[model samples]
Target: MPEAIQFVPYVLVVLLTGIPTWKLLVRVGLSPAWAILCLIPAGFIIVLWLIAYRRWPLLEE
Candidate 1:
């Protein structure tokens, strides 16, 4: 039971970061589910580059 309490903050952090990330990705025309990638160090940076370059698939003209 005590161990479970320790996981609460971790879960909250993921939700706090992930939810907004998902929305940001969706607004940029990328898949919203990619939000889970923000939880990873490399993926987080990759997402930043994706946005910085405006390289989402939907951006192709």
Candidate 2:
């Protein structure tokens, strides 16, 4: 096995989680800029998501 292959799973996980996170954020008042904070490399995304969801009302179903 190659070293790069080992990271493939982690990379896939980021994309998988990122997509839905972005969609959920976009559903609320946050702009795409804020929603895409999930792409950042730290707890910033999780904290932002939590705050945003807590602050904004649900936009739709």
Candidate 3:
């Protein structure tokens, strides 16, 4: 496989994960900048844990 082709899947995966992370953080009243953590090592795990267990301060009535 071409070296350049190998990067395509990686880029796609980032996009796939980033968009949802951004939206989820926003929905829960967190800063969208938190989504960038998804691109860092072990950050995705932290984000998932936060999303699963943290209480959202902006819950709609």
* Candidate number achieving the greatest lDDT relative to the actual structure: 3
lDDT of every predicted structure (CA atoms): 0.78, 0.64, 0.84
Which wins on TM-score, candidate 1 or candidate 2? 1
Task: Provide the clashing-pair count of each candidate structure.
Answer: 0, 0, 0
In candidate 3, what are the lDDT values of residues 1-61, reduced to their tens digit?
6999988987887898889999999888778888888887588888888887867867545
Superposed on all Cα atoms, model 3 deviates from the true structure by an RMSD in Å of 2.2
- Candidate 3 regions with alpha-carbon error over 4 angstroms: 57-60
Candidate 1 C-alpha lDDT tens digits along 1-61: 9999998987887787788888888878877777777777577778777767776565575
RMSD of each: 3.1, 3.8, 2.2
lDDT by residue (tens digit), candidate 2, 1-61: 6998999987787687677666766766565555455555674467465755575675343
- What is the alpha-carbon lDDT of model 2 when measured against the actual structure? 0.64
Name the weakest run of 10 consecutive residues (lDDT summed) in model 2. 29-38
Q: What TM-score, computed on C-alpha atoms, does each candidate reach?
A: 0.70, 0.57, 0.78
Clashing pairs in 2: none
Model 2 stretches astray by more than 4 angstroms: 35-53, 58-61
The lDDT, on a scale of 0 to 1, for candidate 1 is 0.78
Q: Between candidates 1 and 3, which one is better according to lDDT?
A: 3
